[model samples]
Target: MSRPFLKMNGLGNDFVVVEARSAPFRPSEAEARAIADRASGVGCDQIIGIEPSDRADAFMRIWNADGGEVSACGNATRCVGWLLLEASGRPSAAIETEAGLLQVARAEDAADGAKQVTVDMGVPGLDWRDIPLAEEMDTRGVELQVGPIDDPILHTPGCVSMGNPHVVFFVPDAEAAPVREVGPMIEHHLLFPERANVGFAQIKGRDRIRLRVWERGAGLTKACGTGACAALVAAARRGLTDRKATVEMDGGELVIEWRESDGHVLMTGPVAVEFTGTLKDRAA
Candidate 1:
């Protein structure tokens, strides 16, 4: 059977979405790798599968191009939201994933009639066990040395787990942080057992922050919505900024608000439709 797919981007973090709600299929690591191949298969940073869920929302299965199955993906979630909205005609929707349940709503551009989306990125997790560090440490500001760059501009980082682990360092300049130089090192640091996404965040104002990220499975992506939310949570935990702020990335900007009433991080951004195609065998 020919499977339908959609190519979408959320602030430039692109994804290839496959709908498998009825005829459920789970791809193996090798299969996922082949499907995500830019040259051979469908090119995408991540491959998202939408399946039926026992919960109120649909289930989201996220896979990296490398074929690794991850618990969560923020940008991909937006892509799923867009797809669900198109199919159901509803303005808002709920999606389930291994990480947890997420509430998503439509964000329409009044001027151009383009569709943007907002995701309720559930509460950020603090504490050593939550961040799941190798050893118990202060998550508010953990020390990570970058070899010779001991006096490195980006030293201590505030860590948080938004389903996925992230380490955010407040830097003088987002561009100044050795993103390429130290991103890999910090990601593979001994302290982080599951590895981590590294981020350098520069506070532009009380309500704005600029950031750069080196994702865990994927390298330097244009944008990482969860990373942005994590950055905001880290910043708030350190008293550097308020709960609600705007995070600017290479692709664009997302408005993030760590709701004080419930602690759920709300991420608002734009989602674009590049095109759609049908693949033979669908799951083959």
Candidate 2:
């Protein structure tokens, strides 16, 4: 069958969103992996499917290029928000993912012709147990030894859980951080029991930060919405930045606010339409 999809990107974190709300089909691990193959398939960092929901407005299922299912995907969630609003003619939306329910919206005069999407990423988890670390330690500055890299700049990490695990290392320069070399090590570190998306962040000012990320299972991505949100939370926990700040990534930027009143984190970014296509002879 020919399945219709929406090719979208939040910053440069690309995704292929399939509208499966009607028929309710779950794409298998093999199929998801095949569709995300850059050389042989549609090529995307992730594949998202919209299905019926029992608890929230709609259900969102995410799969990485490696065919592994993940709990949360911030970039793809914004893309799904845009698609749902366009279909329902609504400005506000609430969608469900493997992690939890999230609120989404279109910022006024947002970039990309008002295609900018703001997601209420909910509250961030600060406790080491919440981040699910192997042992109880200060999550605000967890010690991480990345083999023989032997750089004090990369040893300590501020861990936070935005439904998913993340380790944020505050560095002097976002560009100079060895994200390509040390990211994979920290991602699979023993401390992070469940593994994690690693982020290198530099606080440019009281309300600005620059970031780069190595996403779990997906390797290095152009951008990571959850990583950005986690970075903001980590910085706030370390008292390095204000609760509200703008996180700049290689692909683009996101306005992040960790509300003092409710402790919820709000991430605002743009989701762009790339193109759409179909897949045939695929499993049901």
* lDDT of model 2, residue 143: 70
Clashes of each: 0, 0
Question: Which lDDT tens digits does candidate 2 get at residues 11-103?
Answer: 899998888879765778998888888898889999888998887668998988888899899999888888888878888899998788999
Clashing pairs in 2: none
- How far does residue 237 in candidate 2 sit from its true spot (Å)? 1.0
For candidate 1, the 10 contiguous residues with the lowest summed lDDT are 145-154
The deviation in Å at residue 258 for candidate 1 is 0.5
**Model 1, position 247: C-alpha lDDT score:** 95
The alpha-carbon lDDT assigned to residue 218 of candidate 1 equals: 79
Candidate 1, residues 1-284, lDDT tens digits: the string is 77788889888888888878888767788877877777988777888888999894589999887888999889889889877887889999999988899989988563556578899989889988988899988999997755467465567799999899999988888878889888988889899999999999999988999999998887888999889999999999888999999999999888899999998999988888899987657454
Between which residue pairs do clashes occur in model 1?
none
Worst 10 residues of 2 by lDDT: 145-154
User: What lDDT score is found at residue 279 in candidate 1?
Assistant: 61
